[model samples]
Target: MDNRTNLDDYLAGLGISDAEESAPLPPAPDTTAAPLPDAANESPKAVLERFLRGLIARIDPELSVTVRETEEALEAEISGENAARLAGRDGRTLGAIEVIAYTVLAKQEGRGDLRVRVDVGGFRRRQADTLTKLAERLAIGVAKSGEPHELQPMPAAERRVIHIALKEHPDVMSESVGEGAARRLIIRPRHS
Candidate 1:
């Protein structure tokens, strides 16, 4: 096919017409440096807590944010009437804030490569429990039917919950497939 034909085919696949295809792409994001916190003397956890508290206060003054550190990671939890708003639909907003918090903390002088997780109203814990139960039910079905089942796309942290939930299942095996946004978990019966 000629270049025009190939371009037309690609645009058609994306449900875009020739006129729509001519629209300019969005501008690139600004790369200017953000102001860093004065974290030189603060511990990693302290700095993370300070940032998270300020973030929650700006969003909702009634909400309270707290941070706790464990050997594995730092957990930041928000509790209040408006905390669910931070959870967003399917926890996207909560996840994004967690990512930004981790990035900022890791860049601080004393908190290199710190791991921080943000949760609103115990949403993460409840979501993990729900996912684990669903995984168990699906694994049983896949084992009985001897058919592989692909789960909905989930973030890496959520996918990890699925894997851990089924790791000890006697008749089912779990594997992650695809890449990036399309990545998901597949449950299949183990071969005897």
Candidate 2:
């Protein structure tokens, strides 16, 4: 009855002094033959999505995540309130998130080849549209003046948009110049 009951006294008091009154031992867990838990069996895509959601929740719990697969990569899009700001000015924050996603994919349990692309509120898509329009406008100017024009150095993704925009053009051709961050595209009147 006291706070610290003696084991022998308690056992005797409970009338459990005989073997039949004692409780049976529970079965031991099967450590070696046990299969993984359901969560551990989740696909790589599911795991990545869960991680992305948790990460974005830190920024704002109201933000929603949508993940899909393309032949080239897993595209994860984040939306809702200040999502563009979350991407940061000129998508610097989004780029960092992308690097983090790729790092996650690299360290995943299975399949090291999967690629991750993190976009915030269609920022990358809109930027691609803007770059494509710029490419088209520049191509027109180059055709008229028969002058070569070089665009300011840009990221490879933006550069690819420019190149593709002018791919079928009659008068201009695009080529990348310089090295590393200094690399840029040159749009010039193609010579026969």
Candidate 3:
């Protein structure tokens, strides 16, 4: 029994006629979705500052702010307990605020796709140091054993730090994998 005959026998067992099995199907409809806009050109930091400002305005019209744009990002200080509300659960509130700010800024700036880092109460800074150390430790382990090591999931800024810090090490390579909240970094020996 040839392969086609075996397939026919299998389909016949399922009670489908040859005509039905051979029926012409419409070409897989081109379901290609639109591509997302690029994020590199988006000013993620400035948008975050605007969001913080909006939150501050709602909390207290008298509140003032200080906005500082760094070469890599932006920072804003609301200067009171109002900042506490934005801080939210484990800085999650700050993360949400930052995302909203980025979305608004990206759209208003005609950028549909850009990521911005937002931090409140120095949360991201501390996280950077921690991620850097973890990356360094894994770099050593990977260099010694030549086995890939996957770290826990982290937000974008932390992942950036890991990528930057390990990028200079000649013996190791790091890249992010996974998606959404589960996204993480895998450090491994670069191919020779």
Q: After the best TM-score superposition of candidate 3, give how far the Cα of residue 16 lies from its true spot, in angstroms.
A: 62
Judged by TM-score relative to the true structure, which candidate is superior, 1 or 3?
A: 1
The CA root-mean-square deviation of candidate 3, after full C-alpha superposition on the true structure, stands at 19.0
Model 3, 1-192: lDDT tens per residue?
Answer: 597566445333322224233232222224332222233343455334434544555555555556677665555665554545556777777776666555555544666555455555566677788878988888888999989998889887778899999998988999999999999999989864
Task: Please report the TM-score between candidate 2 and the true structure.
Answer: 0.74
- Residues 78-110, model 1: lDDT tens digits: 999878878999898998888867765765533
Local accuracy by lDDT, each model: 0.75, 0.73, 0.63
lDDT ranking from best to worst?
Answer: 1, 2, 3
Model 3 regions more than 4 Å off: 1-51, 60-64, 70-74, 77-85, 113-115
Give the top-scoring candidate (TM-score).
Answer: 1
Candidate 3 local distance difference test against the native: 0.63
What would the TM-score be for candidate 3 when compared with the true structure? 0.60
40-144: candidate 2 lDDT, tens digit per residue: 456667656755764675567677789998898888999988787888978998998887666555544446788788889889999999999999999999999
Report the Cα lDDT for residue 160, model 1: 95
The clash count for each model shown is: 0, 0, 2
Q: With candidate 2 superimposed using the best TM-score fit, by how many Å does residue 8's alpha carbon deviate from the native?
A: 50
Pairs with backbone N, CA or C atoms under 3 Å apart (clashes), candidate 2? none
